[model samples]
Target: MATEAKRQKVDDGSESLQDFLQWCDRVGLVLSSKVYVSKEGTAADYGMLAKDSIEEGEVLFTIPRSALLHQGTTKVSSLLEKEKLSLESSSGWVPLLLALLYEYTPSQSHWKPYLSLWSDFKALDHPMFWSKEERVKLLRGTGIPEAVDTDLSNIQREYKDVVLPFMIRHPDLWNPNTHTLDLYTQLVAFVMAYSFQEPQDEEDDEEDEEDEEEKAPNPPMMVPMADMLNHVSNHNANLEFTPESLKMVCVRHIHKGEEVFNTYGQMANCQLLHMYGFTEPYQSNSNDTADIPVINLYKAATQGVQSDSDRRLIEERWELLCQMTQDKGAFVFSKQGCLTDSELHTALKVFCMSEEEFSEFKDNEGWEDDDDEDDERISQALSSEGLLELKPSWKQLIHEAARLTLRSYGDGEEEEKVVDSDRVLMEDRAAFKGLSCRQRRALQVRFGQKMILNRLMELTKL
Candidate 1:
């Protein structure tokens, strides 16, 4: 009976998908015969698939501008326009959210077929929907918990301060019972996960500089068929915007029966899991990065400095850094697990100088070229590799900082070291399969960070 029920569900889904495609055609959405939508196994429920071999540079589909769903194109646009100030003041996404809320509430909507594609709210995986306990348990050190909390707080505030007031005024158009916070939150998740920001036209850049500056950037739009293609780090297709329509074109050849992948820009694992509720396997996302906070470095520098005078000197040096530039953001490790940040290196150099040397350095306002020999030597030493050749104190500082950062991860348990060997990585990838989806994605995010931290420690020979 269970097997029969599963088959029935699949059949219903297939029919719904067909209806959506027919609706797309009626709305002038042009799809190439060589490409169609199909199941992508576990990577996603449905994705664009190659029905036959597709060549590079081939246009797979084109979506008419009228077919795109946003505040401008929705049937309730004029009604929402009356509340434009209220919507714009609350959030950039509010206009579209209101449109979607009203359109999705009624039994009949112009976007009924397109909206059906996203009917399964239960299937959403964005970390924002996860319980606070689940987020803490699975994603404690992944940086997603803080982001999820911020989004939740914003959603609650907007619903109370903006949405509730708008609904209360339009009692005849919208029922509070139907347009509840739960439904609004679901639509917000859809916007976060599925919407795409329309790129500004190049011609817009030539407009009066003052007028362009006054204009707000384009809001996110729900682009049907385009959003159906699942994302991968190294994807085979990209979306191209034209004056009249949006087109999906193949960037590389796709073989028959292969899934046609599109990229969501070069996002890291943490971002992928936070926004989309999924992540590429470990080591697969090329744009991955990890941040080590500046406070960690400061803590490391002050660890053994017992003199109150020295602590004051350290604080003054930090103030000088702040004066030079306001970028106190975290130092990041690149995809190759290397720290090539010049500001961080400069901070270390400033922090390492003795009191007298620091006074001279500050008097010079950070290294003038008045002494040619001294300037030449300093120039050579400031090269990328030279910057990495740290003093003993700087080396120890980095080592301690990385260790402290790792300790911030779950339960202070040491992360398993990942060797730079395919054999070890394959073993790890195989092991990833036994974990639940949430656990596996969480591990991918945290492990990616741990790998970078471990690599940094190795480079410094700690």
Candidate 2:
């Protein structure tokens, strides 16, 4: 309670997306009141819809721990001193940017809680905060600057006009309490694990350079969220290591008026966005050539099919299923939260298609002209009142990955199969479409021999 008498506070609070939807309908998490706009929804990022059919992989919005501040230590003068927080009106520097998110979390196992944010800002009792000509301008703003140094751009324009607009005119940054987005999502996951941490972690390890001089920890800024998930690149949200809080049952179903997408680049297209800076917002939209199947598990650890810890567990479960389908805005593949009991039936017969291979293709004698086209397809899957079930093990793995792309052979001039499904290749549309109802049932359960006439031409063309 060191208020120094509420130092001219600011909270009348009204930023209202109807009080962020009456605090997300008093916290049950369902948001989709049909609000899509780009021309003027006023951009601090917004997009919504599903007034009706959203079945595929359902859950579209979530962030709880009573909407976040989970702290441990972030001492830049205590985000000016915690004053004990929580939404009964969060106080001052939003508890010092959520005590810089107790320094590294998603539930930290590494970066040792950012070394207690550099030993609590070098045990600050303000030992002249930073004078030795400001430690030679913080050791010349510790490199990575090249073209700007009017004394490190006047100390980062005096930390963005007098310390980040006095920590963005505090009053809990604004809103009865915004938890400054759990302190800007721990400063955007400490800026995407900050250029992948360690170069002897850029200084501050002293056992005795005359001992006391520590305060360096505030660098955290890598802005990815899967490069703000817009612009699809043949996505299935497999940013893979399977972390849906240690999976239990959703290999694929995700419907409810779909937008769910993920695949930053190459388990074939956009190739994990070339290792992840991501970019598609219709850069002149068109397929832009993406057959994308680049499987080098380095050759499943020199062609043994698995082990170098199962090829680093298939490259850390395909980069955490493309960063959990770009932070769960859409792509929703669920290995039942992920594997068990005989490795979850061998990862469900290796990622999906077996009701005993559909009764051994309905006992084939060329079964009465495929039983008059499976009786005009069970009367149009009972006149479309809920029927898109193709999972016979992801249709025998997308027709054995599309007949191993009609017999692989890179550096080509040999791809003219007598059937050209209009082969456009790129600028965007040719194969991938709005697909999601759990990615057309994991492409008919892994490719049910080209999804039974591509599921009767996408249910007689939608």
All models: lDDT?
A: 0.75, 0.29
Model 2 misplaced stretches (Cα beyond 4 Å): 1-77, 80-423, 427-462
The C-alpha RMSD in Å for every predicted model, in order, reads 5.3, 26.0
Candidate 2 lDDT, tens digit per residue, 1-462?
000010111122134234434544464333334212121121113223233444434443433323222232232334444434331121123333334443333335222322222222221211122334432322221111121223334434434434444555554533313333433433432332221211223234453345576543432221112222233444333322121211111124434444334322322112212212122322221222213122321122123335475555545444433442343221111111111122222222222223344234235411223334343443333232212343443334433433333333212323233113212321124343554222222222222222222332243232
What shift in Å separates residue 61 of candidate 1 from its native position after superposition?
0.2
For 163-184, candidate 1 gives per-residue lDDT tens digits of 8899899898777788888888
- Top of the candidates by TM-score: 1
| Alpha-carbon deviation at 399 in model 1, angstroms | 2.9
What's the lDDT of the predicted structure labeled candidate 1? 0.75
